[model samples]
Target chain A: MNSQQIHLASRPTGMPSQANFKTVDVTLPALQEGEVLVKNTWMSVDPYMRGRMIVSDSYIPPFQIDEVLEGGAIGEVIESMNAQFPVGAKVSNISGWRTTFISDGSDLTLLPAVGLPDQHFLGVIGMPGLTGWVGLFKVAQLKPTDTVFVSAASGAVGSVVCQIAKLHGCKVIGSVGSDEKADMVKAMGVDAVINYKKVDDLTQALRDAAPEGIDVYFENVGGAHLEAALNVMNPYGRIPVCGMIADYNAETPQPGPSNLLLINTKKLTLQGYIVMDYWDQYGEFVEQMGQWLKEGKVTSEETVYHGLDQAVDAFIGLFEGKNKGKMLVKI
Target chain B: MNSQQIHLASRPTGMPSQANFKTVDVTLPALQEGEVLVKNTWMSVDPYMRGRMIVSDSYIPPFQIDEVLEGGAIGEVIESMNAQFPVGAKVSNISGWRTTFISDGSDLTLLPAVGLPDQHFLGVIGMPGLTGWVGLFKVAQLKPTDTVFVSAASGAVGSVVCQIAKLHGCKVIGSVGSDEKADMVKAMGVDAVINYKKVDDLTQALRDAAPEGIDVYFENVGGAHLEAALNVMNPYGRIPVCGMIADYNAETPQPGPSNLLLINTKKLTLQGYIVMDYWDQYGEFVEQMGQWLKEGKVTSEETVYHGLDQAVDAFIGLFEGKNKGKMLVKI
Candidate 1:
């Protein structure tokens, strides 16, 4: 049987439209001696993927025209000839967006939640959770009493960052797109949530939310939000940038931070984190995270889209702030 | 005996004028218990003092109008009742531009130099030296083989930063205001020196200077200098801020870095340092610095003014880039 896949038909000038992708079927060779066949069950939609799509030498490869649109995905071992992953076993792999895939199993790792739903592999227990945990602990290196300000706080990573900071005894503050997500973030016991869209004075809202001054900023949404954070950031504040969601859609970069001199005056540290480079420490992260999970110290929310065809819509919703939490497509 | 001292007569609008200082002689009383009278020998003129002259609340209080401007200085104890620092002993103290001083000897630390020029204590062996060492190793934590970029590369702190970084097996780049200072920096083993004044493109000059990318930045001058460094800074680059000489004389606070979003994109770490705040580590620093000096790993230079009368001239020359190395008033 031929394998069904989605290909990149055109390079996106701004946002990736339906015209950017083309669905087609291609014949696949039989599994090699060490290869395993995976039937993709779920896929992830992330803002960073847009960076990879651009023809720049970023953290990941650029998508070529008329090629399979590929990224992190969860799949089951439908046909495995290797002892590592037997046939009919459940697994998650980076087979991109494909109905079935043959794998040598070298880069493929087993997901811990074997009994859980396949969508969870694309949500809390997967890459988003890892990104949040690693970026918060490694990049931010938060202190317990730190007053944190998180941009895009209702999203998967921001939501996890708040919960994790709360677990670390931090006073958490979040900036969300709408009053509803702000309320949702507030309901999670985040000390404060700013509806950035409603706030006329961005700096004042941040200062009001974090009265003591922001010590740690989990920065994802950039542009005006970062400027506002710069104003309210305390001396020696650290900003761990997981994504610049606000700048991703811009055809050209915005005139970058008009107030960056604050970095010297306030002594701020801004770090952009891409979690894939940190997989070596994943075992240690999962161990601590598993404990946080069991003790109820950390919790997560999701925005799941049913059917593989909805991947584009789910990914597009990220820029529009339609997703409540982790934006995932269940294949 | 009456002691002559220069006081800050008025708050400066931009570059300070002669009217900004009030020179007066006051009769100093005899020393009391545990007190010693210090005769100012060599006085230090630093970039940070410009910041302190501004009326604002920061890590340290701003200089008040009609008060003597004080900073790190080296003096000789003329009379002492304190056993810690006896008479005829040289000490490093805060000697506000004055002929004599009354101190309790509690905060005073004896200078460490044997037949070495006493003024070197104000330059390499004094607070400026400590500032470079503390900001570089403790705050920035620069590693061996790191590529370093220094702004105001001929000033008291910046000059030494290049030498210290070189001693630590790092490739160093510097930007100076004058061709003579640039040559001096290059002679001191700095790999490259960008004459920012003549350079058509500050960013391109920085890139060409540091082809491998800048790993650490010793920031003595802010604004355009910082913008240039940001453009070519490596991911996770460390910026240790000692001063902002470029903006020190501005009538109004200048527009900050227009590209500070690079901090997030490059994952840079920028830290502001006040040398005295890290004084507890000075003993260890001085000990190591002494070895580096004795082994000829580091050299010293100074721009000395003959008398207290030239203090204003010396200070003003700093802004004009007239002085190379440490600008000091030999009292």
Candidate 2:
């Protein structure tokens, strides 16, 4: 069988272009014993993937040049030699940016029997959802009385953060780049929504929106977003830094928030985290998130491309703020 | 009787000058019931005092123009109207920058009879000591196996942190501006000492000193020191920000470290704190520190200036790195 996959042609400088990636077709070998063949239906394109394109020491290793890229994907078992994964069963794996691949079953997880669409498992109920849960509750240590502020508020993890904070009886303020994103986040029960692109001063806008001051800041977009959040942070504020999507594609290192001194003056706590650190508690998160979804208190929003050919465009669209929610590719 | 006090003549724009302060002699009123008269013997001039010179919202209110400045001080109770404090008792108070004051017994802490000099209460046995202790054990949560890096390592709080981490069996690396300061920090059992002034690249110097990478960075100096520490930090590192003495005198806001994204890639925790937050645990810290001092595991170091006339110079010297250990004015 032939499989089509995307390969990292060269490391990206600043914003990525189509020339940085290459589409390659390779023949798949017959499945060995205990192996399962998966045909990917949906794959995720996340901002963190930009970090893996560069050669540097990071939490995860950098992607090698010419190698097929990998990420979160939902697939179905077309053929299986393992009893754990039956034929025709849907599963989740980390063999994304490809249409078909053979998994050893050890890396494949059987999708839950929930009534939600298969793509939902790649977004709201998957890694992004778990990231939002861990960062807001465990990292930030959110309280019911906390006035929460979130950047990239309509993005996958951020939308989850906004809804969760609101559901837990916290006043949530969201910052989005466009009017459409603002409305989407506002509909998620956020107390206030700021169209950051329209605002002359983000600090003033955040201050006006959150007159009580923010006790917890979910840091998704770094740069000016972090600076503004610091300006309006209350004493003993908690900042859980989940992502810095704004600077992910910078050609050169960008200067950090100048008011970093506020961390000392305000006695703030800023912690960075990755979802993989909290995988041990995934079962608990899934159970709670499933309940919220069943009760219609939460949702899964996606902006998906049609085929594997558009995967590069979908990934690049993330840095351009072209996606309202989780950016995905349906292969 | 008369009291000589140092008043803020005007707020300083950058590094303070003698012109910004004025010494005034005022007549003392008769002590009321429950009041105690304190004749200050030793007054402290710390880097944190620079924040008070500017009118801004901070953990503590800024110093008022034409008003007496306050800080940590050790005094003798020459006369007392309260029975709880004896006539000759020694006490620690927050009425520094003055030769004498009338206290209502509310802000006085009786100095323990540990056979140490009274001025030790203004440095090692007082607020600065408690700050290092809390920031190391409670904030950084240091482990014996961890590699610790401390900036301004020969100064008041940093010296205490170096000793405490060493006593706990951790490998310590210290950064100081001069060979004399480096020698003092090295004598405290630190594994490595870097004379940052002689080094061409702080990041390279720190990398050579800590090849295994740092697990905890005791941040007493900000700017390039912080940037270098971040470059050499290990995964899941904790940074207990004590003070940013290097930027204390800047007339305008300075740009922060450009590689702040490493915090996300390495999952670093950078927390800023004031010693006041841990006052409830002061007794516990004092008990431990007192034992350490008696056992000769810790030593008090000071750079003293005689008379209240030198208080302004002593305070200004803090920004210029003129003090070796704790900067004090013996009035």
Best by DockQ: 2
Model 1 regions lying over 4 Å from their true place: A13-19, A30-33, A258-268, A288-297, B13-19, B81-87, B249-267, B294-296
TM-score of each: 0.91, 0.98
Clashing pairs in 1: A36-A103
- Kindly give the stretch of ten consecutive residues in candidate 1 chain A with the minimal lDDT sum: A113-122
Tens digits of lDDT, candidate 1, A1-331: 5788888787787877888787789999977888888888778888877776778635457888887877788878878789999877677677666677788887677778534456655666678888888888888888898998888999988888888888889999999999989888987889988898998999998888777898988888877888899888888888887777777777765555556556666767777667877888878877777677666666657788887678778877888898998888877
TM-score, structure 2 vs. true: 0.98
Error of 1 at A313 (Å): 3.0
Recovered fraction of real interface contacts per model: 0.41, 0.80
Provide DockQ values for all models, in the order shown: 0.37, 0.83
lDDT of 2 by residue, A1-331 (tens): 8999999999999999999999999999999999989999999999999999998898889998999999999999999999999999999999999999998888899998878788888788899999999998999988999999999999989988999999899999999999999989988989999999999999999999998999999999999999999999999999998988888988888888878888888999999999999999989998999899999999887898989999999999999998987889999
Candidate 1: lDDT of A58?
A: 55
Alpha carbon lDDT at B123, candidate 2: 80
